[model samples]
Target: MSLEKQLNLLKQIDNCFLALNGKKLPSPLGVLDRYLWLHEKAPYSILAQGGEEDPYFIYANNYALSCFKYSLDEILSLPAKLSAAEENRPKRKLLFDKVAREGIVYNYNGDRVDKYQNTFRINDTIVWQLEENDGEVWGQGALFWSKEKERPRLVYRI
Candidate 1:
């Protein structure tokens, strides 16, 4: 994606979070600097999915890519539902429904599985609609922290 597009979407995520929680997301690099820090150096995992029936990941920061054990291209091609274990998809759907109605959901905790089938629990996640200023919903964005503190490590590159 173009840098402009990336920045716009990141801004939406930041704006939606601020609107819901009355505070910007924690970022030592500063809020407007999210486009750079979030993608390259932020500690938190960030991702966004877009589409209607079966949304696919449209964006996944390096941290998120590492957490899911997938390269950017791989993650962007998978359906968002696949992020969770098969059994957890129903619960994930319910949470998506809630976000559709509420615009944003905070403190979401869930079990997620990576491409390698390793399971991990994500706590205190923030999920929000990637809505445009005019009210068009493009997709959903999320922020989470992985247990690992190191830089993104890709298992495979394609």
Candidate 2:
């Protein structure tokens, strides 16, 4: 991803969070520093989906990529619904609906499946609608994390 696009994504996440939570996501002030922190240093799992009838992942930071056991390229091509198992999709849809209506939702807990089909649960997630400066709803974004020990066994690519 281009530096500009990453920076814009950070702005979107920060603005949306601040609008709802009354505080900004903490990061360094400089552009490059903030981008690096988010992608390489931040402890949270961060990701966003593109706006589509069936959305595809548009972004996933290092932590998120690791948690989902997907490479950046692999994830960007994935449908957001696949993040959860088939039986759990209905619940995922409802959560998205709530985010659409409420603009943001905090402390969301849900089960998710990784590329290896191992199931894990996410707790205290923050889900929000991604909106542009002109008020267009672009998609949705999420940020959450769990300790490695708390997550399911991961199957690493050989």
Candidate 3:
């Protein structure tokens, strides 16, 4: 499809979740709204959020869902570590720690596991800290698959 057509479609989809005035809704609902928008615009994108103790997925687009062969509910319920291969778990945790301390970490390459427990290489995954009004840190991540011969690119931005 043409870019214009795709964008129009995305806009229509976005309208269903976001208010007409463009204000976002509450926590998980707002997350879901954006998820639907991104899913329509870029299905391959993965959206994740982490806590002090666990990295849980708060949202993922349909393309991301299909890539992992998971339904939305299944993916959201999973810990972020579940996406990392067993051997990569330690490194992933270390990277998460780095993001927590520094506010953001970029260009990190690693393998991520899908629902079927398949692993895919993520070339330039970014992890960032999400802060509340009080400045407490929460974890956020954007994951994307790299193209052949090119560096891995971030599929979505937080």
Candidate 4:
């Protein structure tokens, strides 16, 4: 939860997120502040990944941590795919691909399984890529919610 020491990394992350804005970058603000705002103010779950040969989760706010039932270190160490059940990975991958190609994909309803095998239906997701100033893809992020009253749907394979 402490990203204060990761100033440069935070800036890079913010820059990647800003790229989703199309041709224009976001207003100037220290990356730390931006991240703090997200960590504190975001209503639902927010998950972020990083640029790596085999990418893993780099960030997850408190709500996300609670939803997934994982501690910060544990979540960050996990592959984001693990968030879904085995049968749901294909749908998740399709969503990932769609986000990569479209820059943003909204209303993505997916069945996300937590660490203890509890399944939750994540609705109204906004998934997008994180790209650097030069358009280099870093990773991705999604803002979504799991409604308590909702049941998890059958994840389609297509």
What CA root-mean-square deviation does each model show from the true structure? 6.6, 7.0, 9.7, 7.9
Is 1 or 4 the stronger prediction by lDDT? 1
lDDT per model vs. reference? 0.79, 0.80, 0.58, 0.71
Model 4 weakest lDDT span, ten residues long: 149-158
Question: What are the clashing pairs of model 3?
Answer: 43-63, 83-113
Best by lDDT: 2
lDDT (Cα, tens digit) per residue for candidate 3, span 1-158: 34354344344323322322233211232344453455544423545555647767765656667767787778878887888888999998898778767766667887778877887777656555555546655446454644424532322221
RMSD of 1: 6.6
TM-score, cand. 4 vs. native: 0.76
Tens digits of lDDT, candidate 1, 1-158:
66677667776677766666676656663345656766777777888899477999988878888889998779978999999999999999998999999988887888999998899988778888877778888888898866534434322111
lDDT of 4 at 1: 41
Task: Tell me the deviation in Å of residue 121 in model 3.
Answer: 0.8
- Worst 10-residue lDDT window, candidate 2: 149-158
Instruction: Choose 2 or 3, whichever is better by lDDT.
Output: 2
- Scored by lDDT, model 1 comes in at 0.79
Answer with 1 or 3, whichever has the higher TM-score: 1
- How do all models score by TM-score? 0.82, 0.84, 0.65, 0.76
Given candidate 3, what's the lDDT at residue 141? 46
List candidate 2 segments past 4 Å from native.
27-32, 148-158
